[model samples]
Target: MGDALDIMQIAGVGAAALVTEMTRSSWDSMRDAVARFFRRGGEERAEQELRLIDTARQRLVDNPESGRGPVEERLHRALAIQLEAFLQAYPDAAEELQVLTDRIQGTNEGDSGGRTTVHHNSDSQIVIAGGAINASGGFHYRAPEGGR
Candidate 1:
């Protein structure tokens, strides 16, 4: 009877340890996913804003009179209008992206915004960010599944 009781206690302790490890891993994965979501969202907003800027620039070059005031003035106004529209569309995501783009464009944000780093622990994160905006947005990390 004594030997049987000791064996049962050992088994219980092992099971508890396994559960703890699994829980920790699961929490880590959840945190990673949230981070990836925010990073990708920011990248998407930045890309859209950039595209708008390009389009506005081309329009200013092609048809100067139709835009706004002077060529440079028109370009600035158009860029601002387009960015405002984007922010309206995706308020939460656009806020961060606008900051990033402003930094990249050497605006008054004081960001020096050319460099950005995103860390992810899975290939899926890469696919999600890249496939959407056609830009490399996230850092890859070893996932729990060990696939990538």
Candidate 2:
């Protein structure tokens, strides 16, 4: 993550992974560490970012059966912005942030999670997608549950 774009991407992934994969016991500590890393400016911004992470985690925990695409996407985008700003203000921190990013990614990320993916060659090919497909070619997505 030496480059700005790579750093942003890694931070986004690391932030999302930390928020989603961490258990309740380790959550607080990891959140604090993340805040500390981004603590280039005042502590208020770091605290706000951590709070946002917490809120995102709560949403995923509350809706475990539902797809978290929206929450994840939003959190990733927000974290990416924060990371970009921090890196811009402190160019020397790219390597340090990369180390932290590696640590976050190294942790076992639990399951592959669940997703509703469609594959079709043409209108003639119908994807049943969690339910039996009818004769007509149409798309139906049933959210996956309990992790895949």
Candidate 3:
């Protein structure tokens, strides 16, 4: 909230929620709400952003089920960056973003039909359906002590 890193985290999580909502039946409502938030830039900027959002939605819609994981991940990352910049310019809007994030994620959670459950994980396995999972950076492993 008070620093760049915190803002980035909020933006990242918020963007993930937004992208996750894109595939839901209630997308239009959420999309319009997001556009309203972007209207801080101006009417024209808002329209342009909405078009980009529509294009991202189209990409999600066009991809086959199995191919959607990567596509969604890409879209989530892009939106996260955009949201981070927006928050940087308008720190006061973080609360508004929280409202959007809560609403979007709340609706998604309320729908139990499309939920995917993973049990007893032993490795890094990702099973993406129509939601966002934000993971960044990479893993580096080193043998403990003299084990290597």
Candidate of highest TM-score: 3
Quantify all predictions' global Cα lDDT against the true fold. 0.42, 0.64, 0.82
lDDT of 1 by residue, 1-148 (tens): 6634443443333222222222232434433332332444477765664455445545544653454236555455454454345444545544344344333233222323345566764445433321135437855556677453
Q: For residues 26-114, could you state the per-residue lDDT of candidate 2 as single tens digits? A: 66776667777767656887777667666767776666546666766676676667677777777676776777766665554332233
Could you tell me the C-alpha RMSD of candidate 2 in Å?
10.4
Candidate 3 TM-score versus the reference:
0.72
- My TM-score estimates for the predictions, one after another, are 0.29, 0.56, 0.72
Clashing pairs in 2: none
Task: Kindly give the stretch of ten consecutive residues in candidate 3 with the minimal lDDT sum.
Answer: 139-148
| Candidate 3 segments whose C-alpha is farther than 4 A from its true place | 113-148
Best by lDDT: 3
In terms of lDDT, the poorest run of 10 residues in model 1 is: 14-23
Alpha carbon lDDT at 85, candidate 3: 84
User: Residue 9 in model 1: shift from native, Å?
Assistant: 65
